[model samples]
Target: MPSFTLPRAFRAARITRTHKISAAVVASASCAATLALTAAPGNAETTAAQAPAGVKPVSANGLPLTAKDRADDGAKDRQVASSLTAGLKVTAVAKQGHTAKQAADRSADRKIIAAPKAAPNAAPKRYANNLDGWIRQSLAIMKSKGIPGSYQGLHRNIIRESGGNPNAVNNWDINAINGIPSKGLLQVIQPTFNQYRVAGTANKLTDPIANITAAANYAANRYGSIDNVNSAY
Candidate 1:
């Protein structure tokens, strides 16, 4: 019988080599698995990067959809945007129409309430600024205030003092020398005019009615009546 046996050193060396080879193979396989795991995320990122322009990527939690679903979603978005734009346009048009109608209504109301034109040959509503008008106005005021005077007396004084000129001013008289010139239709001085000034008459002595009223009042106070005065009164 023949017995076959290796040397102890050679056998130990062979066993050690086998163990190292096995360890190397296992380490290589584990490294390959790690590389595959790392490359999987990179491949997924590359796919995402290479996707079509303007196309929305699927969300992480969203379900996958076909091309028809994507097309329908895009159509719905466009339809909604178009509907909103149309609604805004219609609202603006309606607002403009309402504003125009309001303006038209206001114009029509103004026209409806417009004043009528004057008649062709109607008499004037105001009194003319003349001697007769002044006397009449003053007489009306005198009657209301219980002042005693007549149109004849006022006319007589106006003619005697300044010849019915309501704008008369006695600048060369003794009263003028005193720096208080007699003014207006009756040529009354400012002091006398102010002293005997009547209510409801113009404050200015140059005013025809004011002068007449004041002169009448002065005459009534001093001489008891303007009818008695005939000269330089």
Candidate 2:
């Protein structure tokens, strides 16, 4: 039997076929890897777009906000708060001013209402009980009341009865024995004095003008006026 030996051309052709199969396998693996890599980018884009509703998109910084965007939002919020605070302060100041004005107005009204009024006029008063003053006062009253008498007639009877003593009292006389003393400047008893006392004259017995006027009135009714009386009746 002769030994069989492969020819050089045949061996070369088989090695070439093996190399081509290996290259084809390497090209197929590379193409599959390229397709996977290209699809990965599309999937990532799709996933980002399909995020949950109402969720904020991520910024370049990976957090919810970038540095410049966060600073601008913070500044705007601060400005809004400052404006509100200033407006409130202005409103409070205006309210306080109005309250103070009202208080001042009330105070002014009270002062006006509490002011004092002017006093009324008054008549003149008497100073003493002198004879001239008493006579003048009695004459004035007599004139107002329509009583008739004169200064001379009054003086004449006052001198004759008790010597012008306003307090004269005759306790030892006959009138005294009957429990009725002659009293005053005219020395007239209580019954006669009280009965004859003029309306405008003093009511007291010791009054000078009262005694003289009462005695004069009594003499006028009984003896036809004091001007005709010369002695003790």
Candidate 3:
């Protein structure tokens, strides 16, 4: 009366179709995974000059010698620096408990005292050899003080001014109309040097290192970075 269905073979054929579909799905997923792996970005590369993390870079205003070394050497010759007093001393001459007005008179008659006798033992502090070192020192100092990146104009300003030579000295430095007495790689004016306490030991100015150190320091304080020197007046 009714048509009868087939037994195991028909069901087996459907199972084969499902197995093929499952294999195709797995293959598609594997291909997608492969593409993703290929498209991924690579790691960043580091350079030779870059120091490993957490290290303080060198800073000495281009001084070939270290402050510690200077101190150590200075210890042997403390007597000499002490003896050679470039500074002046003032003595208050009080006449056996004088009155207030008498003290005032002494003040009016203030004497410019002379420095004491001192020995000249230490050699002058030396600056670096070339211009590159001078520039690097200036940049390093700026970097240390957390100067902003936009202030990079300083490096360029120095090139225009001193050609990056730390020992660069201007012939006219300040009052010299013919030229200005600018010293070191940055060609800082003598007046500027006096104001900034740029002079250190016997002769750090002519020294390229000292010049760079002082110049960058002055630039940072006055302009917030060398970039100001580079960009505007």
Candidate 4:
């Protein structure tokens, strides 16, 4: 039997087919190696998922980190947590302080509301500047000083002594001869006036209120009361 040699085109086709099959086999082997590498325990994605919570498997430069890096990251996380806890405590304390201040303010407001209001000032009492006014005013003062005299007694004495004259002076009497003339509505002498002069009255001998009060005081001391003096005591 004689061996037949194939054409150049058929030979070239066969070589091309062989080359394609070898390429296919090589690609399949490369794919299988990639699949094995992906399933390995040292894979980046699998390692990252299997790592503990809050731990990063890779660094910022896209490289896998060591155990020291993970520990540093955990320490940073704890530091942040501590700072947050301190912030929360401070906020709570501030809220408590604010609530206490509000309560204090409310208490102060209640006190203000419950406090009594001040009464308005009343107008001052007034009196006329005449003889009747003077007698009434002197009577009020005498009552306060515990001196005893009635309006009728005072009026009768004034009519007899000086006829209601506030500036009367007894110049012809023995009291005048002694150089201590009796003066004023009640005819009181200088020494007696000075001794028995009521407080809050004018110092002048002829001053109506002063003279009346002083003479009435002297009458009360000597005769027990001005109402008992019907003569020139």
Best by TM-score: 4
- Model 1 stretches with alpha carbons more than 4 Å out: 1-126
lDDT of 4 by residue, 1-233 (tens): 99999999999999999999999976675565455546668645565675444344457785568888778877887899999999999999999999999999998888545666566795655668877877888898899999999998888898899998998999999999999999999999999999999999999999999999999999999998889999888
Position 16, candidate 4: lDDT: 100
Report, for every candidate in turn, its global Cα lDDT versus the true structure.
Answer: 0.79, 0.71, 0.55, 0.85
Give lDDT: candidate 4, residue 133. Answer: 79
Q: TM-score winner between 3 and 4, please give it.
A: 4
Summing lDDT over every window of 10 consecutive residues in candidate 1, give the lowest-scoring window.
51-60
Model 2, runs deviating above 4 Å: 1-128
Clash counts per candidate, in order, are: 0, 1, 18, 0
TM-score of 3: 0.34
TM-score of 2: 0.42
Which rank order by lDDT, best down to worst? 4, 1, 2, 3
Please give the RMSD to the true structure for each candidate, in Å: 16.0, 19.5, 45.6, 13.5
Q: After superposition, which runs of candidate 3 have C-alpha atoms over 4 Å from their true positions?
A: 1-129, 145-152, 172-174, 178-180, 197-203, 231-233
Which is superior by TM-score, 2 or 3? 2
Off by over 4 Å in 4: 1-124
Find the 10 residues in a row with the least total lDDT in model 3: 42-51
Tens-place lDDT digits, model 3, residues 1-233: 99988779989999999999999976675555445434544311121123233222232463334567556655757766665543322113243335667888989899889998666786743536555555555455545655443324555766777676655556653445645566655576666666654334234556654555566667778876555675322
